[model samples]
Structures are given as structure tokens and as C-alpha cells.
Target: MEQRSVGDIEGPWIEPEFDSNLIRRCRENWAVSIGQVANGVLATFIRQRVGLSIVVPEAKCRIEARYDDDSEMYDGELAAALADLS
Candidate 1:
């Protein structure tokens, strides 16, 4: 696994310039989403064990990349999703 910096362009990964605060918020939100999903899965499993039917919904992990109005930022496949939302 290659480590990528904030704006490294040498590798295949998209290294768009972004606000550090945006990155931090995205990371925090990602962690919370993961924790919530794990908790839900655990609860559902435990309920099933007690003969209570339960269905755990799937979660989609989305890391949104945003840029200031003056800056241009685009990730290959991600561009479409971003554009669609806009």
C-alpha cells in the first residue's frame, strides 16, 4: 500500500487540493458512519439469535471531495457523482 500525500500527483490516485478542515471533517464522519454500521450489525445479529427477525441495512461509504469556488478539483470516476449532485 503506497502512502499518498495531500497533493501528490505521481501515483494513480487523485490528489486534488482540498481544505485540511474538509479532510478532517470527512474523516470524522467516516469513522462515525462505520461505528454506527457496526453497532447496527451487532444488534441485528443478537436479535436474530433470540428468534427476533431483523434486517440490517447496507451502508454506503462516501468520501465527498469539495473545493473552494476559486479552485478546481476533480477525481476521475468521482467527478460524475459530484456533478450529478451539483
Candidate 2:
């Protein structure tokens, strides 16, 4: 399996597709709820996973969540985690 570092998500969760307008609009909404879900929902998901860890450093606004990309609702959960970071 391929593993991506948590640091990479610190910036933007680049939309898989080529569009940006919808992504930007959706991200705005996600940014608002990140705090509520990231700490609770996202953390739980990461914790349950085998090789994944979600770390929120006090110094930097970076959230690292490593796990199976094929899991259920994986992208949504990850987006929540990334939003929660900062």
C-alpha cells in the first residue's frame, strides 16, 4: 500500500477532479465544521485504523491521518480532519 504523509494535507485537500469552483465553495462550508468533526469524528476513525495516526501539533496547524484509502467515506472524513487542523 502507498502511504502519504500527514504533513501534505496541511495546505489544501486538492480536489481529485479538475474543477475548482465547487471545491472552493464546499471547502468554505467544511472549514466551518472542521473543528467540530476533526477532533471527534476524524480522530476516532484514525485511531481505529491499523497504521494511521492523527497528530495535531501545538506549533503548526497540520493534521496527519494515515490509513486505508478504500475505507468507507474516506475522503469526507479526511477532509474533515484536514479542515480541523488549523
Candidate 3:
């Protein structure tokens, strides 16, 4: 089997082809949730068969709030949890 890093793939889910517009819109706004049900199964397979470790980094806001549109930001809890896991 070919070795793969976690970053080697796109986001941890697959969507229907027709949902491209929705996917694009979510990516544009950064409101997409991480992972999916299939991702969990895939991760289990990778762990058992490939013995690879996954590292999920912290998500932070890149753009500052220009108005009322971009104020919501990551509080670093996810990042800190990942760090602690490592």
C-alpha cells in the first residue's frame, strides 16, 4: 500500500457530484465542518492496516473581522486538544 500523510488528501469527506456548488460555497466561507462518517471508518482502516498517525492542527481565523461578517473565530480549543494528544 502506498503511504499517505493526512495532508496528502483533501478534506475528510466525499460528497455527491451535484453538491459541488454547496461544497464550493462552504469552502469559500470556511464554514465547512471537519470530517464525516466515512472519514471515521477510513481512519480506522488506516490505523489497523497502515499504522499511520493522524495529526489535526488547530483552526484559526485568517481574515480579521471587517464588519459583522467575520467575527466568529476559533478559540484554539481544538488545537490545544490535538497538541495534548500528541
Candidate 4:
């Protein structure tokens, strides 16, 4: 899995008027990772089996799985263990 920080993805284009609290919330609550699976079926299986909140983009061979931080992004060990299971 390749992980990226929110700032890396969003860049510096955010409007100046954007709420600081909202930006902080996003930084605190979200994590982004990119990975490729064999196909849609395998991707779906992983999503269901892992039980982590994820979004799998449609693709023939490569897919991006976006994992939502339900554990407040602090449970890396748990996430790693579950990922190994899947």
C-alpha cells in the first residue's frame, strides 16, 4: 500500500476563506492509500472481507482503495493485522 498525506493530494489550492476547523478536521480524520488489485471481484472481496470502510474505483486491472479512518487513524496495528487477514 502507498500512503499519502491529505496535503499532498489537496495541494495548496484551497481557498483562503475555507474554514480552518474544517481543514483541521479533514487532516485529522482522513487517510489516503493507493493500491492495485487483480480485478473488480478481488477488490470487492477485499472490501467485504476486510470490513474497513473503503471505496474501490472501477478498473479493469488496477484499482485504488480508499480506506476511511474509523479508528480515528490511531490504530495502525489493528489495521495492519486486518489487512494481513485480507
TM agreement with the true structure for every prediction: 0.20, 0.22, 0.20, 0.24
Q: Write the per-residue lDDT of candidate 2 for residues 38-83, one digit (tens) a residue.
A: 3333343343331233233311132333433343355555546445
Backbone collisions counted per model: 0, 0, 0, 0
- Quote model 1's TM-score: 0.20
Task: Give all candidates' CA lDDT scores.
Answer: 0.28, 0.37, 0.31, 0.35
lDDT of 1 by residue, 1-86 (tens): 11222122222233347756544433333323222323233232223221111211211122232322221233332234323333
Q: Candidate 1, 78: how far from true, in Å?
A: 19
What RMSD does each model have against the real structure? 17.7, 12.4, 11.9, 11.8
Backbone clashes in candidate 2 total 0
How many steric clashes does model 4 contain?
Answer: 0
lDDT of 3 by residue, 26-48 (tens): 33322222232123323222322
Supply the TM-score for candidate 3: 0.20
Q: Which ten residues in a row have the lowest lDDT in candidate 3?
A: 58-67
Candidate 3: deviation at residue 25, Å?
26
Worst 10 residues of 1 by lDDT: 50-59
State residue 70's C-alpha deviation in candidate 4, in Å.
4.7
lDDT, candidate 4, 1-86, per-residue tens: 42433334444334455576544444333343333222332333333342133322222113134433343224343334345553
